[model samples]
Target: MLIDTHIHSDTRGLEDLELMAMCLDGVITLAHDPFEMKNVKVWEAHVEKLLNGEIERAKKVGLNLFVCVGMHPRAIPPEVDEALNKIRDYINHDKVVGIGEIGLEKATKEEREVFIKQLLLAEESKLPAVVHTPRRNKEEITKIILDEISTLNLKNSNIVIEHCNKETVKWALDAGFYAGLTVQPGKLTPLEAVEIIKENKDFANKILLNSDCSSNPSDVLAVPGTVLKMKIEGIGKEIIDKVSQKNALELFNLKV
Candidate 1:
C-alpha cells in the first residue's frame, strides 16, 4: 500500500517512456501535480488532460492517481482571479484530491494573496491542502502560513504543510497541521527524515512521506529508499506505515 502523496507526473505533459519507467518502481498510488501554469487557458487544459488523459494512462501501467491543483506563488500570472475561478471548478473534480503545491516561494504579495485564498477555499470545500514553503526563507514563509491557518480554525489533520525541514516541521506540528517531508536531491535526505521520525515519535504518524520526484530518474527511488532506511534503523513498522501509508490516505481521504 505504498502511496506517493506528491509526484509531478509530467513536467511538459505525459511522456510514455517516462511514465512506463515510473511503473517499475511499483508504488501503488500516486498523487500527481496538476500545478498552476503561466497561462490560465493552459492551466485549465493541463488539468483537463491530467484528469482525462494521464490518469487513465497511469492505470495501464498499474498506477492509480488523483490530482492536486493550485496557483503556485513562484509562477503566478498577472490575472490570477481568472485562473482561480477555473481552478475552483476543478477542485471539485471527482479525481481531484486537494489543492496544493500552493504556497509562497518569494512570498510576494501576489503569492501570499493567492495562497491564502486557496487555503480558505480548501476549508470551504472540506478538502485537504498541500502547502509549500519557500526554500530561502522557509521559516518566514512557514510562519506566514501558520498565521493565516490560525484564522481558519480548520482541523490540523485536514491540511498538510509540505516540504518541511527541521526548523519548519516543528512549527507545523505545533500548529496542528500534518508535516510533509520530501526525500529528494538537495531537500531532506533519507537519514534526516528518519531523525525527524525518531525525535518526534509521538507525532510521527501525523507526518506524510513524499518523493516530490521531478524528471530525474534517481528521484523515483527516494520514498522506497527512505522506508528501507527506517526499517534497518529499527523504527517501528506501525510508525513507518503511518508516514508512508495511513496518514496520507486519511489526510486526502483516499485509498488504493
Candidate 2:
C-alpha cells in the first residue's frame, strides 16, 4: 500500500484521481497558496474543499483521503491572522492530519512570521508539520528553516522538511526531522531517490517519499514507481516499506 503524503488534488483533474485511487491506499492533500492571494475567505474555502469536497471525491474512488491545512509561504494572504484563526477551527477535524505545505519561499519577514505561527499552531495541536523548501536557494533557506525551528519547543519528529534534495535531506535527518522526498519531473527522479536512500544509513526510518502531484507536470504514481526502482536496485523490502508507507502513517497517526 502507498500513501502520497503531499498532493494538490484541486489542481488535478478527475482522470488523475481515478489513476491515484487505483494505485494508492491513501493520500494527504495539503493547502497551498492560490494563484490569487485574495483574503482569508479564500483559505477558508480551500480548507473546506480539502476536508469535505476532496475527501468525498477520493472516497468515491475507494481511496482514503487525509488533509493538512495552512497558508503556503508563497501565498500568505494579507489577512494572515484571520486565515490562521479559521484554520484553528479545523485542526481537530477527523480528516485533518497536520499543518503544512508551510515554510519559507522567499525568506521574507512576512513569510517567516506566518511560518512560525503555523508551526506554533501545529505544536499546540500536537499535529505534524510539512514544511516546503523552495527550488531556488534551497540550502540557504533550509538552513534558515532549521534555525527557526530550533528556537521553537516543537518536537523534531513532528516536522517534515519537504521537497528535500540530497543536501537538504541530510540537514533534515541531522536535525532529527523527517525528510520528504518529492518525486516529480523537476524534483528527484526514481533512480536519484533510490541512490539517496542507499547513501543515507537507516534512511527508511526518517524518509517519506511522495509525488507532490499538482497542476505542475508530475507523475501521480511517483511513490509506487519509486518503490519499484528501490526493489530493482536491491533495497530491502523492510526499508522500502518504511519509507513508502509506515513512516507517513506513524507520523500523521493515520489509521490506514
Candidate 3:
C-alpha cells in the first residue's frame, strides 16, 4: 500500500509506466506547465498537452494517478499570472491533488509574487500544497511560508515542504509540517534520505518520502528501495509504512 507522493513522470515512456504500474499502487505526478510560453502566445495548449499526456500514461498502466498543475518558481514568466489562472479552471477534478511545485526561490521578488498567488489558490481550493525551497534560502522561504499562512489565515496543516535537504527538513519538522525527500539515485541517494529520516525520528510523525523521479532513469522504485534500506538498518515497518504511505495519504486527504 505504498504511495509515492511526488514523482515526476513527464518524460516516462510506455515501458516506464508499465514498470511503475507493477511497482507501486498509486502515484501523484507533480508537473510544471510550459515556462517558455511566456513569450509565445500558444503556451496554454502546449501545457495542456503535456498534462493530459501524463494523466493518460498513468491510467494506461492501471495506476491510480493524479496531477498538480502550476509553474515552478524558476519557470515563472512575466505573464505567468494569466497562464496560472487558466490552469486553475482545469484543476477542480477528483484526480487533481493540489496546487504544487510552487514557492519562492533565492529571495526573488518575482518568485515570491507567483508563490503568493499560487498559495492563495491552494487555500481557496482546499487542496494540500507542494512547495519547493531553495538550497541557499531554504530557511528564509520556509519562514516566509509560515508567516504568510498566518497573514493569509491559512492553516499550517495543508502545506507540504518538498525537496527538503537537511536544514530545510529541520525547518519543516519545527513547523510541524509534512516533508518530502526526492530519492533520485545519483542526485539525492536513498542512503542520504535514510540518514535524514534516522536523524529526525523526533519528527518522524510528519516526515514523507517521494521518488521525485522525472523522465530520468535511476534505481526504478526508489520509495520501496528506501523502505527496504530502512528496514535493513533496523527501522521498524510501522515507521517505514507511515513515511512511505500513511503520512502522505493523511496530508493529501487521500484514501489509502
Question: Evaluated with TM-score, which candidate comes out highest?
Answer: 2
Q: Rate the local accuracy (lDDT) of all candidates.
A: 0.73, 0.89, 0.74
Q: Determine which window of 10 residues in candidate 3 has minimal summed lDDT.
A: 33-42
Q: What is the lDDT of candidate 2?
A: 0.89
**lDDT string, candidate 1, 1-256, tens digits:** 5667777665423453245346333232222334545576766676576667767777666566777877666556667788778777887777788887687777677777888888877777778878887668888878888887787666534788888998888889887778988887777889999998898889986898887765544366567678899999999989988888787777777756
Write the residue-wise lDDT of candidate 3 on 1-256 in tens digits: 8888887676566677677778777778775543454542455554465468777777787876767767677677567768677767768666777777787676477777778888888877778889876656667777786666557766646788887877778877777677888788544678889999999976777888888776555555888888888988988777888888888777777753
TM-score of each model, in listed order: 0.87, 0.97, 0.87
* Model 3 TM-score, all chains together: 0.87
Query: What's the ranking of the predictions by lDDT, best on top?
Result: 2, 3, 1
Tell me the TM-score of model 2: 0.97
Kindly provide the TM-score of model 1 when superposed on the true structure, using C-alpha atoms: 0.87
> Candidate 2, after superposition: displacement of residue 249 in Å?
0.8
Candidate 2 residue pairs in backbone clash: none
Which window of ten consecutive residues has the lowest lDDT sum in model 2? 33-42
Q: In model 2, what lDDT does residue 130 have?
A: 94
